[model samples]
Target chain A: MNPFKTIFGTSAVAAAALVAFGLTAAAPSAQAAEKTSFKLAWSIYVGWMPWGWAADNGIVDKWADKYGIDIEVVQFNDYIESINQYTAGAFDGVTATQMDTLGIPSVGGVDSTALLIGDFSNGNDALILKDGDSVEDVLGRDVHLVELSVSHYLLARALATLGKSERDVTVVNTSDADMIAAYQTDDVTAVVTWNPLVAEILSMPNATKVFDSSDIPGEIIDLTVVNSETLADNPAFGKALAGTWYETMGIMMSDTEAGRAARAAMGKASGTDLAGYDMQIASTKMFFDPAEAAAFGASEDLKTTMESVRTFLFDHGLLGDGAPSADVVGIEFADGTVMGDESNVNLRFTTRYMDMAADGAL
Target chain B: MTRLVNRHPDRPTRLLLAMLPFALLIAAYAIGSDMRLAENPNDKLLPSFTALGDAITRMAFTPDKRTGDYLLWVDTVASLTRIAGGVAIATVFGLLVGVSVGLLPYARATLGGFLSAVAMIPPLAILPILFILFGLGELSKFVLVFAGIGPFIARDIAMRVAELPTEQIVKAQTLGASTWQICTRVVLPQMWPRLMDSVRLSLGAAWLFLIAAEAVASQDGLGYRIFLVRRYLAMDVILPYVAWITLLAFSFDWLLRVLQARLFPWFAPEGASR
Candidate 1:
């Protein structure tokens, strides 16, 4: 017998045994059978603090037990990459902006549905310019941003507001994390990005917010988008996951000591303290109450937002040639039935779960 | 003398013929770009040619400074700088390790075997550990490139050293030559050709490592550019960078060959077969 092969075989067996032992040791609690696990992907941001909070506290597990399913949340540092990975089938669900849901997964032909309306950028996402320049001054100047992202959409909206076309300025495709560094280097004259990068860049001497997501209001909404197949085959999993989100939100908005502790834990997990986390949550305009989300779900606002996003995605070359209108992106109920007219384009929301939760039916 | 150097009268014609396909491809692409056949609207071809013609014209005349959409040139230069830096470090470290291990048998027995084992380990497997140790900077990239090329060069040179003709060493010893004299005068002279060969081979490996290292936790460089383009689904930017990287790699390989031919002319005789 070859000595090298013998040693290699022994090491492989040892490694396998160690991995098996670790997995068995970490096997979920006795109530694991009552719950089915669902994976959630999120980008690192202050607006996403509730996700960490839910996982750190027993809120996710409690909600799963209530709905008879398991929930697991994974975080990604890059928002676009997380969406892309979700589209590529790495995760069951991902947090994404409305524009990305239309442009990325919907365009890529992956059937996806918005499981939860997370938040909309209020003042968190912005276009910062050097001091002494108005929004009008930005016209015909190069604008740097993560092209085809929510920030890019904000820039386009800003340009339109100034009676300018996209061609009026050069749009450099710079990432949100690198926008601050690029601004510091004097390589770009203007940058559009989201916080905490926006916050960091605003600290520079000449930097000031010339435009922000508030201009577009609900157009830049964020959602927890789930794979259509996962929702269809595992409706219980989807309900459990949504329940976990509501539970986490309850803790976040509560004024109790445990709630504060939960917020602190979430802050630490997300690399921020309680006050800093609160500032981020406020800037994001998050919906912290399940009742509020249920009310929002029944409104015409979300429909209008999805319609505008679908058209924007088409113009940005994200949608495929002669593709079906955005209505087919799977906004269906737990019973796997379509919600409304295919031509409505704006009605990309399923209010069934939210209505049930609000009425104490779940 | 001109006639003697030009013995292969058809060399120029052959070189032109070899470049014809590339030239035609560039022309076709340029014309396609001018005609708006190149999917991207930001296409920049010459003013006279349609979109396709402009693409051909732009392809012929390399863009230096930023023009219409010529910021790609800056990206290309940045990528080339990273590749050059990585290759330079790899060559220096590889040569040092290769020469030291080749000269010392006990060193070869320990360090050479260890390096060979390390060379077999995939770079991706070690990237996370390196990230923790080096903190995602140029130092991490340099370390990965050094590790990747050093072991290969060391082991190759060790094998070459073991294969050195015993007769040469014996002859040197019979002449009352000291160990240092044998190494400097006899061994090094004979080793130069093989060392140069090792460098040529290691350069390709080093270039690969440079790109791979740049792919992880890098804000700038060719690999980062490739990664960012993929995220936005911008295949147009991806293609041009791919072309630039291919051309750069080809140029480096040619440069190394020219250097080898010039520095070690004795390896090929004057009257050798044409």
Candidate 2:
């Protein structure tokens, strides 16, 4: 018999094949009619490690079970691509820095809400100098970093301490992947980068951390942001995500063997050992307690940090062509405080989920 | 009766025919851009032509506010210099070593397996090693391009050199030509076209290594610019840069083709078996 005979001559076989594929495809949707499923995207970072831990240790599953929903965590090798995926609706939520959350997704016109304020960079990001000790010494020097990224923003903020600006020093746009290698060269005198590259460079001889995110506290905040439309439709998603995060944060910050084991695992995942991961954690001001995060989200300091971020973004032309001023994209904080144009609020820093987590309502 | 095999296109018609595919591609892209824009005016996936034009103008024409450099020209010059340096060094090294290995039995016994082993070691895998050894500078980028494509060029030249008629070498020796004279005078001239053609074939890999190296650790280059704007999802800038790179690569390939034909008119590239 010819192989094409069965395929071309019989509608019966075709119908059976169609039924098989259709049933398989429809099986999940049938079960999901009452229940729900969501995907969360995360990348490697000290603050973002909890997402990995929660997903691996079944904490995410536990919360999803409690809420009668399904949650899957996805990891991306590239940080920006993770956020891009979340913005393009591939994932319901993503781990991102405050500026990146505002710059790419919010400014790109994706309405997103911060489900949880995970942490802020303390000394996680640094401006390292090969020979110098002060930010003033960066004068007439090429500071290598990824251009238009948070590192560039950190450089700007660092230089501002000495009453200088980005123009005072030349920025040699280098990738984070090559940050440690580039610094080994005699030509690269200064570098602005985040951990674990910061940790790697600091371990090297003659590398001095001149300035870091600690100086400008709360500016480089990290959070898990969810699509506004998704969260609005399914409040269970926001609750489960926030609950899972704080629970994982509790374990990560604890002194138990489980906590130590979790850290070790995260260290291994991020291509480091326990001590190196701890070093990164020391520079990261993670919000293990939901109460502290809520307060931070509600504080006037959040608004101030956002203003600087928006201004920096506008200066870099990241606000898109429709934005005439920095005030075009609205940012809404907790307690009814809205920054920028209230008519178009794309990024909302809501403390509601964190408050619920704190009050044990979640 | 003559059919498709016998259909020979005239030179003018062939030139016009090449424009059709490009026209079709442009039309398809325009339609995609229009449909996407109609759905969402702020879509970055497929930007409108006006936005792309503005991005190109900004990059190529306007002096950057901070550095005060014409960015596109600077990037082009920097990338071109690295490629030229890498290819030139590889060419000289390839010719000398390839000629020796092809002609001398001692040279073949010593370097033949070594060359093949080196070629098998993926250049990208050793990129980190290159950075560590040479430091992350232009030299590392150049060496990466060399390591990636140098072996390919060398092996081809060696094969071509080996395939050279034994009669020519015997006749040269019979006419009182020394081994060195036979290599430089007879084999060298015949393989020049082959050398250029191999380099032309290896340009894609050369560009890959150059872009990868630049993307990793350069201040100013086409790759650096594209990656720098990627964080912002600036597809308008990225697509144009990609198009510019393709245009540059195509021009290089075209020039090599023209040069091969002009300089070695008797060499038949069409008869190349591999």
Candidate 3:
């Protein structure tokens, strides 16, 4: 026997594969029946904080119980990995950005529904140069960023405004965890990243924020997207999650001490102090009111955002294997209008749940 | 009722036994993959071997759109070069310190404990410090691999030399051999094969540090590729890269074993006595 295999008993390799496969074999038909329990995955971000806080504070439980279902909110360390896990069917729902919602999961062929638009990154994502007076100084230089992330998207947009393409500069793929330390080096003069790393980097001497996501508002949006199949089978899961979210959103956006405490707890949970978390929250254009979220969900602006996102993702080759055109994946908006290839609609932006919340129907 | 058999297994039997575990592992993986794909055809984790094979062909055969370079081959060459450079530097430095410490009692007394202490200091713990001092360029990764195995090599050599028969030294001295002559002629020759063996043992550790350093920060390497695709749950790409690393490590070990056997005909491999 191989000593490594003997020692580890396959180390959950065989078991994990079997379990995942077994679940998949039964998932489609099994999900058609009622599901009493479901898992939702979230990551550490200012806009996504309410999910964790709501889960911890029993707010998710309260809302879930109201619908006679159990909702478990799980946290992921890496943002993109959480969406990947959702795409893998490990989670029923996940928190994602507009780009990732269209790019990673949709491109991966997992049908998803945008249940909630929590916030838009106004000045949240930025480009910082150590010594450059303008973003154009990045020409012929290597810009460090987490490649394929919103940071990469922001960098591409920033370069476009200057009439420069990705060919103008080299992209050095760096992790968000190491970006700050990398920026301190003389070798790395320019970096494109998102908060709270963006906030921390800009605090450094001579670090200039030459570009931000605020330039194109409503383009970089954070969303709560659930598996369309799961939502179709268990509508209560959507109602439960939306109800819990807006309830927590109300507390988070309020000026009362209860609200402040909730925000502080969320900040601590995300490994940042209240002040730091508050700074990130400020840069986030949060849609606290369900009426506003419902309106945003049903707006023409979302279609435009999706169009731009598809173009950016397609141009970057992030739209998956052999993606012949930008219309490879169809996006169904809230008003039943489908954009792109209608037969292959993978992304659905539903306003019914949000409109219900706005009407206090939940 | 039973036929008489040879006490030792023949070459075919030995080879069969050697391959059985790997064959079983492959079977287990295939069955697991089949089950997963049956459930969800788009399952990324625990990808079928066919998926892995497809990913390998894509990465190795096709050029990336942006760079127009075959990334797998580029990554392999980059990783191999870094490890080779780091290991070569380590071998020279390790041999010099190990031999000096072993030959001279004063040198051993002063530096022996210090080298032991250095070996105990986990190289990974000081990775951030190395990055801070050396910058995030190739130097940091090189230093990581060098620091990871150099001390262990030195300590092992020191121990091997200390355990050598004292009579050899006395015989050389009785022949009116100078201290330098005794050290250079008697010690260095015998220590060479052992050094090669030590290097074979350190290759595993050297790869560990190299990959960790690369995974944390690098433009191009096998570790970088694995981590970069990890966000997408591209296990098809990752598992193949892991196998490739294992193959490389195994090949290096086999080469060293052959070199040791060819150069030192009298050296007994472990379990040969039984």
Candidate 4:
């Protein structure tokens, strides 16, 4: 009848059951078994259009079916909140920028892998200034953005280009949706942000594009990140997802009527029409071809990019305590090949699935 | 000398007294800024003076474009209405429960203790459960504030009733008065002043809970506006609304005090005279 005794008795029975069953309770029996169900979270953004396309066209389900699993996609109005939910174990996967993937999951001790590289910002992200003001004019002026985010990184890079340290300018933390309104109030002199906010701000009479992501292309990569344990237990899940993504990309990029129709549907789901969506895509510098992504996966450039990103994140006090080596960002393909720092081992990405897609056996 | 001190000042003396501090401070500031008021008066003093003047102008005159006047008036009315609703509910429940428990010793021991225990639990701790049942709406906010103050008021009234002088009730009974008449005429009137005290205490408690409730989920109230401004880091908007809320709290307290004095003049005649 003692309270402590009752509590311990109940917990002991539960722990015994758990220990008897072992951890991988619901894993599939064979390679061709029915696919597991999953939910993915993402915020509204042009770069994230492909996720909607995959969902509407049955590409995500088809890939899941091929992999023997079911998948559900959920949308959030706030990107950081979506990432937060993912970190809190609310979703199996999340579509977020690379910086968020590192900051939210990698830092929060959730071993996550980048399953797919959606796109990198080209001209979509920018630092806008009033007319007649050069980048030098922005020196010592406050630059507003969502601090500790990709926009902040872009601002730092832009400032570095002008031979000015980040110390030269004050950075104000402002949400993307409110950044335009803040700029309108003249509370701050400059804003570093992404579209459609960037597009809206540029339409203002005195607003001018002082610099954009074009100068530092491929730095702001959008990715589909998944938990490490999920991938480890079900390797085929990764392969199936990548295989379906490549197939969907082929449909989207083809010159066929079906491809155009798919793209238009994708645009609609993303809150933009086809032409507007295309403009966003053009600025995003997306890798439409699977072969190119696979080649990029094999190249040394990704390693260099990740190394620099990790170092920059650490230097800016964005990374958590006890600096993680650059190697933690590395991706090891299923085959013998590896990219990025070897010592920096966190579940970042496994090129194994990309290799399978490249070989046409997925 | 005392009569002279109270005498009305002539125009020159009044002007001199008014202008003395102003002239001295300006002279000191001008000297501190290393500018001669005679020669470079227009340029040197203009910017600093304009900044101060602009601030004063803003405070005295609410801009039509900002819509501050409409917002200020609406927020004031909304907060007052919420407090009134809470107080009205608390008064009815507090009086009924208090009188019942106070009259019965058995009820005092069981129900009075339970109500006091309930009052000890903070309302915020139960907000999520309330939200789940009542939903994220005005009803939830009302329930939260009601729950916060209702039990305290009830228990206080109950305790006050139990401790009331029994001699008066016995005297009324000896005069051949009916139980109902004795209760209504003697007991109720005597409890009024104490009930007002309970109400005054409950109003402050209710306002605290009301602001907390509004801060979480309600859409248009002052707390919600403050939270929205906080999300955008709009310090200007936040500061003005904060000032409005402070003014509102002060005004409501004053209104309650005035209502008490006007309705129950005998409660504090000496205090009012001073």
User: Largest lDDT belongs to which candidate?
Assistant: 3
Q: Score each candidate by Cα lDDT.
A: 0.65, 0.84, 0.85, 0.67
- lDDT by residue (A53-76, candidate 2, tens digit) is 789889999999999999999999
Off by over 4 Å in 1: A1-35, A321-348, B1-225, B232-274
How many residue pairs clash in model 4? 9
RMSD (Cα, Å) for all candidates, in order, is 13.5, 5.8, 3.7, 22.2
* Ordering by lDDT: 3, 2, 4, 1
lDDT of 3 by residue, A187-284 (tens): 78889999889888998898999999998788899999988888888999999998999999999889999988998998998889778888888999
Q: Assess every candidate by TM-score.
A: 0.61, 0.89, 0.91, 0.54
Compose the digit string of candidate 1's lDDT tens values, residues A1-362.
Answer: 43444554566556655544442332212222332666788877666777766776677788778876667788887777787666655577888876777666655545677778777889889988875367887876668777667877888788889788687887765545445555764445688888777777887898978888887787787788876656767778767777777767777779999788877777677676778666666777787765676566556676666566666666654554334644444444333344333432221455555655566665
Lowest lDDT block of 10, candidate 1 chain A = A26-35
Regions of candidate 4 where Cα sits further than 4 Å from its true position:
A1-35, A322-344, B1-274
Q: In candidate 4, what are the lDDT values of residues B45-157, reduced to their tens digit?
A: 11234434443344335442324455445555666677667777878888988887887667787787788788899988766566566655456667877888888888888
lDDT of 3 at A347: 94
Worst 10 residues of 1 chain B by lDDT: B39-48
Top of the candidates by TM-score = 3
The most accurate candidate by DockQ is 3
Kindly list the per-residue Cα lDDT of model 3 for residues B39-107, writing each as its tens digit: 656666667777788888888998987789998999999999999988998898888899889889999
- Native A-B contact fraction in model 1: 0.01
Q: What's the distance in Å from true for residue A166, model 4?
A: 1.7
What tens-digit string does per-residue lDDT give for candidate 4 at A1-362? 43444554566545544543341222112232333777788777876777767776678787788777777878788777677666655577889877767655565545688877777889999998874456777887767776667787888788788778777887655546446555665445688899777888888888988888898877788888877776777776777678767888788888799888877887787677788777777888777665666566555666666665766766653343334544444445434355454644444655666667777878
